[model samples]
Target chain A: MKRAVFKNNWVAALMVAPQLLIIFVFFYWPTSQAMYWAFTLEQPWGGGNTWVGFDNFAAILFDDLYWYSVQVSVVYAIGATVLSVGMALILAVFVDRQLRGFKAYKIGMIWPYAIAAPAVGLAFRFIFNPGAGIMLYLNDAFPGAWDPNGNGTHAMIMVIVAGAWKQIAYNFIFFLAGLQSIPRSLLEAGAMDGARVLRRMRDIQLPLLAPTFFFVLVINITDSFTDSFGIVDTMTGGGPARATNLMVYKIFNDGFQGLDYSGAAAQSIILMFLVVALTVVQFRYIERKVHYT
Target chain B: MIERTPILNIVTHLILLSGLILMIFPMYLVLVAASLDLKDVSAIPPKMFPGDQLWVNMGVAWEKAKFGEKFLNTFIVAFGVVVGKIVLACITAFGIVFFDHRLRMPIFWAVFITLMLPLEVRIVPTYAVAANALQPFQVFMDVTGLTWAINAVTGIEVALEWNLLNSYTGLIMPLVATATGTFLYRQFFLTIPDELVEAAKMDGAGPVRFLREILVPLSVTNIAALATIMFVYSWNQYLWPLLVITDQSYGMVAVELGRLVPKITSTGGEVAKWNIAMAGTLIVMVPPILVVIFMQRWFVRGLINTDK
Candidate 1:
């Protein structure tokens, strides 16, 4: 028995080696270096590195720009998360009903999620371009309606709308899949008990979808912080006095533009901690409310 | 039986039609803009219909964007990344499952932990390592007199002088190890029945033979799904390529097209050629869009089923 167990164990280790090596080289090594660099000030053009302890972190904590970026990121993450998950839930419920052309609705609704972010950003850029954009034309049609390009506040709104539009399709797909997994018999039973469609959704569907909703919340929040950098980078470039500079975008600028390796690393570490803490809090406080069945 | 009421049917169709319009409108506008002459691009309300400048715009875009070379570069980069990911992911997953030992759990944990570390966190250090490693490798090859042969096959020679920034290897190397692919394969392999392995063993089959003959054949669906996902991901990848590939000389179609419109339009209030940019954007988006439209049913089904 001991020999058999040993033989089985050997096979598993051999199988995992290549993956382990790749991960070490690509993921683990780089990650550790980033952590190390967070404590040291280094020049971009290959020079002597001076250990700065937590000075980078201290500077970032006190910096007005950094705090503003953090605030923008948090707001964007929370807003995008709520809007995306809410829209997805609504769409999922709407589509779950017995209706003609259900398949078309499902596919069409999720198609935007399939479009690349750059492409989506470009499309939205064109749509919201000052004089030539359709949205701008629409704004013109409505007198005194906010002009997106005229001010920083409206520009940020446009960014959020574009971001939320791109995210809604992704969230909808996940929620639709989750909705499909709910037993049809339970829905039928609710109908039999004289529950209307909205009542059924409120009483049964939302509770059962807690797990999927929770997952979407985590994914959207993380992605809003990480992935929205591209959209913001391309669209606004964190413009109008850095009003749109979210945390990840700030990290990108710090690392790539400012060449402040220590500052970027410190920002990354902070972002990671925040994400982990948020995920943990969700799991601890809200996860218990999820009805798995 | 649930009754399909007329009002509900109308409402559902309205909702779906509106969404479809919204999804496709931007693409439609791009096509229209691409066809129109530059003057029409910034016209009030934008051009709603196609114009005669489609060919002219394509010509301009091709010339301005260096379309041919960039297309080839993008293809090579995307292809290399795809091939490397498939090969590495399969081998690693196989190793993790078959090579059982005291080190197995630790190795597994290490790979799994990468899922939590976002790629942005590690970019600076990874760039440093890539920059440093390329220098010595180049010198060693030049001294050993194997530079030509290495260059011919691997394309690493061009990569030595930071020319690789816009080259195939630069775009592909960073994307070689995908945590999601490994996780998927690990789960897929775990489902393979022990009885099948035992039967193969009884016939004196080794691990490699059993994997090749039995496991590979049964994993077609999983492989197809993974390939589709990876292909879409590689096609959509923007940041890494943008970071490494510095020259316009070696840009991908997406990046090149992105640069061309801004560069051309920003010159002297010539009114940025919305049409050309739209056309280029549409062209860049076509391949991935087609893949999604065609394989969406399988893709969605695969995503849901593979999670377990």
Candidate 2:
């Protein structure tokens, strides 16, 4: 209610000053710079630019490599999202059936979110290293058949696996929450008709959990899109001839390494729009259905 | 509880345990790799068991890799971000919800835009802005002829310099404005009964006094939960410090751990040993994992709630 008003504009300004100043300088200023550079021609090192309208966007839109990066990002996001969400859904469903050691599963499962993407990347690097770690035995049997370091396809797999590993813990929590929210009477109704567990889950539980599934789908895709930087940076640095070069990583590569400020800014704009578009779609789709609980 | 077959229960355990193994395997790899010596690590097939050089490798990571300084920097940055975010978010939410302001919604949505574009997107320009923070002061000097003005006024010739490039403020200041935290606190505040606000008003307390005395106390649990998540998030930030700080002294553990993986020495020789890298990885993981484990309940609730 607006009735609890502290009627002083100065006090309000004082309170909102810190966040406003920070967001203005860091977020809005940088964003505007990126947008301006996206529309101009700029020298990364020389730091002077000419106003060139739509050339950067035109080049990026027409470039095969840029489109390739987008394709790789889509595949990576889809692979990561599907793998994590599917495994998490399975784990959550099975765990929902048991009562013995839920605490252990809960503790063990919620941990990946704590571990950073780089940490996950490094840990998986150890495991997936061909010479040492867990992959050593496999290489011993296959000689040269399994080498993620030299193989583009396998490199993509490595990144996807690590990305998915990072996401599953998050997806698992949501799935578990969603599973809990399914009414017990619905399952009982299915059981009275002699439906098996699978049938009951397929008919009653899955339909009821559709909202959660949709919610998880949006979250997983968005997270996978933006958060894949760390995993890519650590695991391969978008290596093997740019096979695993995701869109975000390409931005960092172009700007920092290649010093293509304008190109990178345009790419950043595209990626920003991609995220905003996903967020809009999520809210618009879920607004009508998210309140089922 | 519907009918539970013993077979199905066993299968459920089987599936869950397998999932657990998948989740825990990489962690096991970290532990195993860290424990092995360079010889064992570089041998024909990798050693799976813990070796005797665990302490040695950890010492190398600690002393040689300069993780001690990195730990201090990371600790400072993370705690700074956490405290800054919570305090600003609380007050901002308090202002938005309890106080009357024309720009409240506008300010709220302004913070919310940060959630759309992550740091990875605008990293270059953000770095540009951070690196040249003294530009405005320079322009001020030129515009007003402030140097001559100051000399005329006080006879002190001075120049302004803001070397925030490699400092803690550089690392944390750019990161502290978050919409999610403010949104959560606002949501929590919306649930606060208006009678409480009215009561505080009847008692002739100002907004600051009401916030300090009432809203802060009511928000302890939410604040703590959000703090756990933010700490992990800030601790795990990969690109912010990388772009801002160039000095080796200010290197972060996450960024430095990436450096341990050296290139192949020669065409025929073995690569750099990973024992130290794995040890560094373990050290990097300890703080956040411990945070998650200790704050399990709050962490879980906070992540699921804030995200959804």
Candidate 3:
């Protein structure tokens, strides 16, 4: 809605055509097809599908394994979010103090952001190796102290740590930015009132950082649900009695490996709702905070 | 720095140092493993120091995994996505902002709706569409009776099909079909002063000329920023390439590295080659990490802006 604009329909259509075609074919078409497949049961062969109504949903809802995947996905989303966001907040607060060597620490911290999740998983896999890793020393004090491969809970902890490690850099950047955006006079006023560093942070700085904190929490949770596939696949493979079978990984496994199209599509629909709900909350509340800040 | 307490400053440095160690230690382990031989790497207590076999292990992993081709494929796909996304997004944003067309709002909403529908959600059907890039056209032809008409005229059956699986186009195209670039460009376009457009018109610059001569030159920084983000995102793609590219020639390094990790189920008989696995992990991480480091300023801005 600029004041000066071109009034050519054909040129505008030509320019927009490629993007429209791409989204329609790649984004919209597949989305609609997923909705279709969710309600229909496809034959094992290339035969046509039967309209199964709510059968797929019913089956998935009735299955205890599906419920377990949902449970673990929530656990991971919260666990990774709490760990990463908490660490990032602490690091950001220290860096915000403008200590000597803050710049180097900032750069060093965000290095993990550049590393991919699966690579993070692999690196941690090496580090948490019970045989020869740093854990080996601990195992000497108490033999059989660390074993991620055999123990399901240990595997969950390993993946959570790896996932959180990769996320710290991202959350740190945001938390640092949020801290920097706060008015210096407010902190100075707190200092003038004889408030110490932690006092100022707890009272003035953290309240102002609430918006960024919430935004990062929503993003981290969504990411843990969908983006943890790489970590889970590389490190645990949802192993030791399906301890880490996150919903996203389960959808892929069921659709591709298990060849249960309707069931996987149903799961996709459910995950889509979860994402859409989170996105709605983001736009509804977070955007307002952006404007306010 | 307001009245710093000596004890608190020391504590701050200590905490920051520990944070740095926690962040860097895993990567340090990878470097250590990559330098050691298989026996030393899998020893009772891990060797903590670097050895002279760094290059040797890298070469071994590179050869074993055919990383030469994998790296090339990753480069091609990454560059392809960058170029494709930038071009399409630039033109679309140009059309939406510069032109007063009737369909502009609808088109914007169309792109906006895609913000919610990530490829991970509709992965199965996206795989189907990618497996046959021309399926929609074939369906259209069949539905509209164009197939029958063409067949009757040409005395042949017509079923248009083009499989994109295992090709560079398949790997690049789907990732390019996103709203991130378009939204970035649109926001940048809105910031351009209206006087520029008025001046261009005064000088008899049409839409295309204005875009080429005026808008594009001004967008260099934005493009550079988006390019850094897009390159890393494309290079780090795993699931799409894992599904689409079955051929070793098109294997992405991330997926290939994942495959190199010995499954926990296979632990008893096979001694995990932590040395080679760590070597491949380092090799795979190099390009994206280099891009982020070199373009640190733009990369950070791009990350924050893209979320906005």
Question: Which numbered prediction scores highest in lDDT against the true structure?
Answer: 3
Task: Please provide, for model 1 over B1-308, each residue's C-alpha lDDT reduced to its tens digit, 9 standing for 90 to 100.
Answer: 35445776677667667666765676677777778886777776756888898888877777767777877776776677666766667767776665556665676667766666566556676666555535445655777877978787888654464434545666666676547667777787787777777787888887777768887787776666666666666776767777877876667766554564452113365556666777777767777667766778766755654332
Q: Model 1 in CAPRI terms: which quality?
A: acceptable
Q: Against the hidden true structure, what lDDT does model 2 obtain? A: 0.83
Tens-digit lDDT track of model 3 for A1-293 = 44689877788899999999998889988888889999999887768898999999999999999999999888889889999999999998998888889889888888778788789888898889887657776787688889887888898899899999999999998998889989999899999999999899899999899888888988888888888888888888887788988999999999999988889999999999999899888777687786876
Identify the runs in model 3 with alpha carbons over 4 angstroms from their true place.
Answer: B148-155, B266-268
Q: Chain B of model 1: TM-score?
A: 0.82
**How many clashing residue pairs appear in each of the predictions shown?**
17, 0, 0
lDDT by residue for model 2 over A151-211, one digit each (tens)? 9899899899999999999899888888887877878888999998878778877777787
Candidate 3 at B301: error in angstroms? 1.0
Instruction: List runs of model 2 lying over 4 Å from the truth.
Output: A1-3, A43-47, A183-196, A291-293, B134-163, B263-270
Off by over 4 Å in 1: A1-14, A43-47, A135-147, A278-291, B133-166, B263-270, B304-308
Alpha-carbon local distance difference test for all models: 0.70, 0.83, 0.88
Predicted structure 3, TM vs. truth: 0.96
lDDT (10s digit) by residue, model 2, range B1-308: 57867787777778888988998977886887888887777566667678877888999888867888899989988999899989988988887887777788788788777877777777888887788656445656867898788888999875666667888888988778557788888888999988998899899998889999999999988888889988998899987887787898888778887777763212445466688888888888889999889988776777766776
Name the lDDT value of residue A169 in candidate 1: 79
- lDDT minimum window of 10 residues, candidate 1 chain A: A1-10
| Each candidate: RMSD | 5.8, 3.2, 1.8
State how far residue A218 of model 2 sits from its true place (Å).
Answer: 2.0
